[model samples]
Target: MPTPSVRRSRPAAVRDRRAAASRPARREPLSTKQVIGLILGGIAFLLPLVLDVPDLDDMGERMLAIFLLAIVLWVTEAIPLVATAVLVIGLEVLLVSNQALLPVPEDATAYSTFLGALANPVIILFLGGFLIADGAAKYHLDKNLAAVLIKPFTGSARTTVLGLMVITALLSMFMSNTATTATMFAVIIPILGALPSGKPRTGLALSIPVAANVGGIGTPVGTPPNAIALGALAERGYHISFASWMVMAVPLMLVILIGAWLLLIALFIPNGLGIELDMKASWATDRKAVTFYVIADCVILAWMTESLHGINANVVGFLAVVALLVTKVMGGEDLGRLSWPVLWLVAGGIALGDGVGATGLDAWILSLFNWGAMPALVVVIVMGALGLGMSNVISHSAASNLLIPLAMGLATGIDGLEPVTIAVVLALACSLGMSLPISTPPNAIAYATGEVTTADMTKVGIVVGVIGTVLLVLFMPSIWGALGLL
Candidate 1:
């Protein structure tokens, strides 16, 4: 009895119902936290226009507001971190670069001013690091390396814990900490499951993240925060060679790693000391893998001898990229798997720092601080403490990004405080906040295994973070002075 139109409408309605049934439900509206972030961001944008600080010019005031807003958003994570990064670039383009607003003479266009951050040499260094990591992963190089490093001491539980910690640390020095933790996580689950549920099982699990976090400090490419600090220092005409960084970082990491091992033994002593792990190196004879290893070693050798070769670290990274592709050790897909989001995040930080320098914001901020009166050691402790705290709450790279410019600003104000030293301290401190699962990727990865709880991590993290900071404070001055950095 229905007309053709009615029949068509009925079928369409039925199809719509079926489609809706298959799809997920509508998500809830903005959370209270997100709404609060929006409000704070709005306030931050508007505050500088009203109450102007003495040292801050109109543009400096506006940039400060934006920076504060960014800090709030980053800490709260109301939006994606990448989105906040984009917001930083966008806001700088509008608020700082706009001719009607606070335009600078150097900026030909707003886009050009901020866009160049994506191609920063430090960023390129990261690109090379990513390629190497991907290639290593694709070729099972990390696993093989881990197997070789951990194979020797699989006899006793205490020795096994040490071996796992050492292997995780060593692998993290070259690959992504998250990847290293995940790789080691699978290796240890069976061993952990074999043991009774108690402190020892928990301690072994906790060691992976602590070691990974500590180990990342050992290499520039080990983590994004390291690259951020290195790049910022380079921009200020201070450069630490790849080998030079390891010279300082490796010794510190070894000390902390051993301390962590002892703490685990003391706090969570294993009942059985006879658990054997099958750590025999696999893929021993793969020619392609060997080729990858050889190329990587060659690149590392060049990096370590940068004093003799005088090749820039980023250039070495590029060479590694070319060598890997030419040798067919890495394919196009492997390159595609690199952490583009993280790169974007770092690029945003670079852009923000560049803006700070270009716009005189750094000078204005430095003027407000009375650093001349403050002790240099106290300054280091404060910065280190702040870096450690911020990294625990937000992304480590984000924390580093926020602190490095401030540290540099402090360096300008504080007589006899080396900018490079402050930068190094800030970067190292960023890695020290491993007390919470959210502090770093490696921590989260281990926590995901359910063998370790948040309480377990928090307890270990607090001690490790505090001790690490204290040690850096004690040794960094002499170390940097020896390197002619102070």
Candidate 2:
């Protein structure tokens, strides 16, 4: 027995170290997806040169096509987004060789457009928000917060869903919708899983997305479309602040939530089928982490709201990034691993806008749409419809980044509707939970729980999404009238 002891199997730490060193490097043979990604990547980078597309001045049309191909790969997720972005860089090289895309007639210059995207204020804001969320998770405050917050609903189904919706809506005022959902998931989904109570009746399924949608509406940074609209409008010198955004956004959220309540009641839940509130004391076990994260969130909110003197919205976001660096919530290496592809895509979109502006094509595109002469309400309806459809087809971020500039260009021709605001309303509403599984991340996230089906979301979401589109069109004019924002 002593001879066979073998020193207790080399101890857990030693065994772990040896096992890690001896590990077979995962040996992931190229998968079909990877193969496709490589082929497409090669085409995107190599095709423009062979095709002999000539670059006229700084036209960069070939680069644009290459970028499109790269984005297609990204959206398909055949490869990682960053990889797709790198493919864009490589294509930039080929396009430059043929003198078809590079503004500076060189590969390095092609990166100017892309690097511009990475350096933007909004992209940086995403980084800051992630850092804050990371700090929140590190201390396990998210779980503790959820445990304490979830205790209040007791066993009632409707109340539990309602509580989550309300909390998500409130938290989303300053955070991105995705980040808010991720945070809320940490707090809420576990409770859903642990329920000896079981999955929510049919009412529980629809209610979660409804709430998530409502919560996401009230903040400038809750979704990208909101940011795009806000940024484009601000570029035209319209000074919409956090408070001003909420003054309008709050009512929009209220209308949608009311509709959701009615819809939920009409479906599975009786008007009488209600949930009871819990009076249990909270258990925020990671009190220390919560303290750090909350302070950081407050700082961000203050900057976003411009509540403090000498600190504006854009300035605040950068400060948060700096805080992330100084506090070591995440390392530089981790930051390097951030979604730079999406960042580059944003840049590509913005550069496209800049390109259009430079070429006087923005004016031409606007004139073609002929949307400038339409009534404000008509424009609202059209923009809303376009937003919902395009978001469902592509992605919301893509639609806004691509379309808002065109709208901004056309605004000069309109008499009443502020081009940027209409764009904002359209862009902000882009994250609707509608018919397709691929429409929005929230739809996918909630659907993947396997508790809800795509068809269920589609049936209810179509009615609700259409209703939401109408709500925005009708409400914007009324609220803007009251606030004189239009």
Candidate 3:
């Protein structure tokens, strides 16, 4: 017979086993990629500190360290993207700002200047956009609008795919690509299930992400890369208003969206297969939802008519936030649901660009290349290609952050290269990078559905990305100049 202590010990062991079984599994603290990134990032950070480059000052060296560390971390995602962003700001304050721990120049940037990036105008605009998007999701406005708008294309499988693509793109223009893809997928999952599991399902799955990714290029608030470009341009005293961005990009967005739709139909969608969609729209009728609708419309209108009201877009964005909070349309929970990490990520880019410009790092880096010898068109093509290629493997905002400052520097070095043209090209090119599941969040979401294979996404993505980049590089600038859009 067992003693009392032994019996008690057995029960305790069982309890421990139960507890272990009930708890969620924990991931390793550092992945192999993360470990490699840390090692490489550390070396990159210390290189500028230990070795002096000719004509590069102390401040530039510090910023260079931060920039190099950022590249490695963002590429490998050793840490969260937002964490890297905040780190950049913190380092700027400690190493190069007016409050530097080391000796500094008289014109060192103010610490407040680095911290103030959190409230940059681009961030304010994104805050309003996030609030409105969240409210739309909460009120079921996005789904209802998509359902109602997709009715005409329900006649056939091909047309229904087109309709879905069109609605997805339209929503993505106003909402984040990830959100738009999620909302559309949620509505269409049943339809996708009803169809045979093959090319048709794959095509339908692929359409949402492709449309969302392409649609993001349509406006300033459509994507983070656009905000990155806008923030950089603002630093250079060149303001491209919301309407102006639409004027410059909507045509390309339409072209690419339609092309992708056609490609999807040809590749995966089979003809004569009828797709029956339940197109009933149950629009919200309650008082709170109605109030939200009014606020969103007014905010978007104000953003579009900045030329008429003379109220800065940033101020208008804040107005929307104040109106929503004051009216109780969105409470504390809704505010908490906003994409705070994204906002911080954009802030970090702004701070990074500011630091690079302040330290003359842009000129030092630009001096390494003979940009003036290249034709303006070739330079633009190269910048666009870099943005497109880098965005495929890293975060789109990260790609923009790394490239836009350099593009600005190139604008100064190359004769006849307009900052507006190069900056806009780089921004839009970043949006065109969706050739893989890892290219963008929308693509990742689409791949997660298990309806499409990586090969499926890669083939379509490569075609769309290449075509879109070619159009953007070879023709858009001429069109913008002809229309006086620049």
Candidate 4:
């Protein structure tokens, strides 16, 4: 007969085997898109080096090669996004930086100029935001807040979805869009399971992602593209404070969120259906949870009052990071869990922008277009549209990374166009893309629930996207002008 310990060990081993068997296998073969990306990326990288272009210097040619390679790789994701980002940094250092293996230009930047991107002020700001967001999840504050705040909208299905979207947007303004969607869905899944499947289910499922996506536009730390834009603008000496970003974006975010809610209700939710969610709140009162709550509130307060206190948002963000770690509310595991990939991606964009400006690639690219002939508003509108369309097919951050530096370059040359306005418009437009499952992580989450079909997301996404983009392009610039935000 086996001993009790032996019997327990056998079951544990059996369970581990079962878990391994259930896991999905990685695909070793490249897809058609990736194959094309790899081939074209190589060709693009070499084209600048091989062909002589008018007035572009050797360093400019090298930077152009790096730029083209980035475009292909980012759009098709032949390599991981972060991989391409680091590649950009490495290429800049090797080809254009003062440490270049091949020398030509007297104005080559120091390698640290590229490496320093990893620690950009915006990156530091995002680090603090990530820590606070992760702490919220660990402490159950997000879910519990949802449970309590969702009570008034519980009686009717439409009202319930409105409440759900409102809370989702509120959370997304502070948390990452993906995290907000996941947190809301965790609470919503049980309710979804309870409901009869069909349009009502689809409507409820779609609401969370739409709200989360739009909510990300509400604050600077809400999404990666926002950080990319901020970093690029800061490099150009145009600074928008944390509170100022919210003031500029939250109004538009609310409009889009409400517009999406109405559209979802009109299209998917039946007129008479009602939804009931479990509203029991289980607030955590432990010492660690209490400490986290206090820290989060203080950090948020400091960010919001930057104009009053005269403290930089980056410093406030770092302060939060130090406070949480010093208090031991978050330890090594939490630090390790921060979105390092996203940070790297943002850093890569900053470095790419630095390289472009430093190498005069921006001037060469600007020479290709008669941007002076076009109306300043038209230029911004075109860039916004490009951002929206590209982000629909690729990663939003990638779209921003490719567009922001060029847009900033255009801003300098165009009369009556501010770099801040164009940059903000581009970032906001990227956030508006959610027409397909792959458009955003939040949309992907919704689609993965198996409730929202591609067709379902497309119809809603197109209408919402169009409405948001039109309003953003037609009205936002003038509004910002009137408010002196620019």
Local distance difference test, each candidate: 0.83, 0.61, 0.92, 0.94
Per-residue CA lDDT of candidate 1, range 363-450, in tens? Answer: 8776677767898888888899999988888889889878898788788777777887888889999999888989988888888878
Backbone clashes in model 3, listed as residue pairs: none
Which of 2 and 3 is the better model by TM-score?
Answer: 3
Candidate 4 differs from the real structure by a C-alpha RMSD in angstroms, to one decimal, of: 3.2
Descending-lDDT candidate ranking: 4, 3, 1, 2
Every candidate's CA RMSD: 5.4, 5.3, 4.2, 3.2
> If the candidates were sorted by their TM-score against the true structure, best first, what order would they fall in?
4, 3, 1, 2
Summing lDDT over every window of 10 consecutive residues in candidate 4, give the lowest-scoring window: 2-11
Candidate that beats the other on TM-score, 3 or 4, i.e. the better one: 4
Candidate 2, residues 1-486: lDDT per residue as tens digits? 566644456588798999999987876677786787667766774564456544323334454455457545655556654555455545544453333343443333334543454466655655565555555555655545555666665555556666666666665655545555666664555555544342344456456655666666676656666666765665567766666777777788877777776776566554434455433334454545445675686766675567546566666666776766666655677577554555555554555454444444466556556675678678777777877777775666766666676767766777777765676667666766456667766666677666667666777778777888787877676767777766
Better of 1 and 2 by TM-score: 1
Per residue, candidate 4 scores C-alpha lDDT tens digits across 238-355 of 8899999999999999999999999999988877787667679888898999999999999999999999999999999999999999999999999999999999999999999999
- Best candidate according to lDDT: 4
**Model 3 CA deviation exceeding 4 Å by range:** 1-27
Q: Pick the candidate with the highest TM-score.
A: 4
Q: Total backbone clashes of model 3?
A: 0
Candidate 2 TM-score, true structure as reference:
0.76
User: Which wins on TM-score, candidate 1 or candidate 4?
Assistant: 4
lDDT of 3 by residue, 274-312 (tens): 878776889889999999999999999998999898888
